[model samples]
Target: MTEPEVSDSLKTFGVVLKALRDETGLTQEEFAHRVGYSPGYVAKIEQGKRFPPRDLAERAEPVLGPLAAKLLRAAARSLTRKVGLASWFHEWAAIEEEAVSLYAYECRVIPGLLQPEPYIRAIFERRLPPLSEEQFESQVAARLARQSLLEERPNSSFTFMIEQALLERRLGGDATTDALIDNLLTQGARRNVEVQIMPLRQEDHFGAGGPMYLAETPSNQWIGYFEGHDSSLLQTDRKAVSSMLRRYDKMRAQALSPRDSASLLEQMRGAQ
Candidate 1:
């Protein structure tokens, strides 16, 4: 595991060890002996002073018992939940963090995962109910933090299918749309991010269903997340994920190629 993943793993191990020891009512020495590790080693792991080896986790699983391992996984998930601003948001963030590839379709605007700060702020400012300045900034910070995934080593592949109308939405007026479109063109050149514009003429496109994101992890598991007026759903069911995947595939086929997409953006900029 890389440093970040290892750090996350250590925290997971520490929480698990502490929970298991408490449940078994066993001293460190007792637990270590049963798991075939030295007492000091177990203590170090429980304190998060060191990361337990994967073998250790496998061995400890049986020693700690099924219930303990299950609880440990749940505890790790609980830690992640606290970081998500909303219940549904956490699930999406966690999955996105672990994803190795991303596919998305957006009808009305840019997807938040790829949006620049100015565009994001403009969207927030136009919220129907409006937000306090502090709340708006806090949400902006959260959104920016989520963008860090784009900077990860061995960057995840991103394919975003957005409607052509999104380029004309003047949330912050012409300059904002121009800048945002320019940013999209810049990102489209990156080897990692693949951006496409669905022509306004494609009224029968698969994306007509709605906006959705399909994320695939290194382990090959797929998840779907779709945002709504006041809520979001992190879909884990294979059938649902497959359905979204099909939609994304069709949308990709219908959207203009990356080069053409960039050219289209340039035309919009000149027209503006």
Candidate 2:
């Protein structure tokens, strides 16, 4: 474990962003609204834990006034990303931000978007090679930033299918499981999000093919993403995307309905 991952350029960008934000006297939430992003995402940009998206300058100019644009441009000059994810993951995450519809199925661990900080910390704490203190913190911030997407895009449809075993495993013990269930319930209650569980007794699970993610872009074009080891594939081949979509469709049918899934989680809250 080492120190914080913020680079010189990133630190300067954050300093300028925070300065402009303070000068305008807008709270993080207020600035986020003006910039069309979540407050948490805006915070990360100011803290340099997440990269400033390219269009941020455009979004800030009007809200912070003409002088603000000059500061943002200066900050933008030396900007580099801070999410700490692989390049491929960065691409997939960018797509998720703008996706009109997203489907995620997982058998290994809780989907990142639905995990609480405790659960997220538990997952990263066990990495094989071990993350530096800074890497660990940055990874957590990136994931939590991504989770904000569920709330940030109210019109976008998001469905997550999780294997029952993952819920029952309690990776970080009872306290973490409690927090996890609470977070899941809270998120699932959102109108645009759906949570389903692949029951343990189901002998036929389409998602047995392994975890996958599918998203429909703003243009209505669909794509699939698959990860293996340290690498990932962003599949745009029509046939491959179609196949993933079909499996998702079948898994959606086999997994417990959202209502039942919530009930199941509630029932598991203290069963351990």
Candidate 3:
């Protein structure tokens, strides 16, 4: 039987892993034993038939030292490239995964990190050209995968300011909206998360430019991301990112407080 094809990124990852293992002067079986996996499993990873586990990089640090961790991080980055995300958004997604802090202001839908599965499905179903079965599933998986960032970095902070109109709109009917609000409330209660509402009645809005995302990188630099239907832009210019950060802060000031936001969500849930 013909072997299944491997993605270029995965193949490159396998090559790097094989090189690293060779440099360690240990056989594949020995390395696998150290990492607490079967030799066959290690061989599959080295041959590009399997992806490394999320903790593999950290787990290899003690035995193989820092270089092993770096290679594993590179391999993880390679795996992210194979996801169905748009090319324009790939760089920003990688930065987002490592952000020390994230701020989001949305005028349309809830941010992907806070969206419920039903709401996410409804949003995709409304695509103009419509997605095929495979496309739809891949998009869902990619979006859900991003939520891991919230739990992976306990020190990371996240703030989401969503337009009240979106909540009131009830995009996927009452049931979906109810579930979505409940999910948001649960996320809001987390120590590292702050969810605020941009009241529809506000006359002074700093976010007139539409949705925007800002994140502070691991190196302490700030970046901005903006997206539309067919294109997205990632901003690294200090002036531009700083300006967006200021506007985000102002928008937060205009929005309901976190406490009030939770109360409003509760009221909406009660009304339903």
Candidate 4:
């Protein structure tokens, strides 16, 4: 696949930022502290997966010197660069950026934010209408970019409740399943993330309505997102959001705890 068609403006800014970081001889973590952002966020910026925040240049000015002006110009240009997200998903993705808390419950497939690279590719490979190479690359890029959220926002609370059956499905075969398990284990270890597994043999599993995505904005407002076979809905309606939130909370309570989830994942990994 050719490049994912990330914003050139952002890529240019990333190059400049990376060059500056190199000059300063600071690690991504160290540079992030200097600029008051998480290392993962900084890494995304440098990888061109994210646009520079409005205040990034100002925050970075002290270390930039003459390069500060260039960074500012690049930041301005980055705003207009094209993104890889589907049209329907763009709104949800934006909300995700500002979300203080996110909850996802998946019975269909792994949530996009939790999918690993091989798992992502396997999904695309099974598309019915057959996506063109360009479309595949674009979709893959968008999903990979979204996965950064787990690491990029340390302050955000991320909760994922996945069905054990999904892991057992082995969509991409053993190798990919192993990778997914490893990735899930790694992500679950993060202080900000919780991975819960709903066992396969539950008689009281009530999350039959389908997969759900919920977010809490910084202002404490809730948003719900649901995707169909061909379309997506972003529900800002209080009742709709509340309904999804309630289902998610109930399912979370029914799923395995984080520690137990880890143990199950480790056992699965060993089985592979």
Candidate maximizing lDDT? 2
Report the Cα lDDT for candidate 2: 0.84
- Give model 2's TM-score versus the native structure: 0.75
lDDT of 2 by residue, 127-222 (tens): 979999978888887677677788778989999999999977889988998999999899999999999989999988777689999998756899
Report every candidate's CA lDDT.
0.72, 0.84, 0.81, 0.82
The list of candidate 1 runs beyond 4 A from truth reads 1-84
The TM-scores of all predictions, comma-separated, are 0.71, 0.75, 0.77, 0.75
Candidate 3 clash pair list: none
- In candidate 1, position 242 carries an lDDT of 91
- lDDT at 41 for candidate 4? 75
Residue 177 lDDT (model 3): 95
Pick by TM-score: which candidate is best?
3
Error of 4 at 175 (Å): 0.5
Give the range where candidate 4 is weakest over 10 consecutive residues by summed lDDT. 1-10
lDDT of 3 by residue, 133-166 (tens): 8778777777776676676566789999999999
The clash count of every prediction, one per candidate, is 0, 1, 0, 0
| Ranking of candidates on lDDT, top first | 2, 4, 3, 1
lDDT value, residue 178 of candidate 3: 92
Model 4: per-residue Cα lDDT over 1-272, one tens digit each: 22346677777778888888888788999988877677877887788776565556767778666576566666665454465566566567767865789998899999888888899999999998998887888888878877767766889999999999999999989999999999999999999999999999888877999888998876689989899986899889999888888777778888999999999999999987
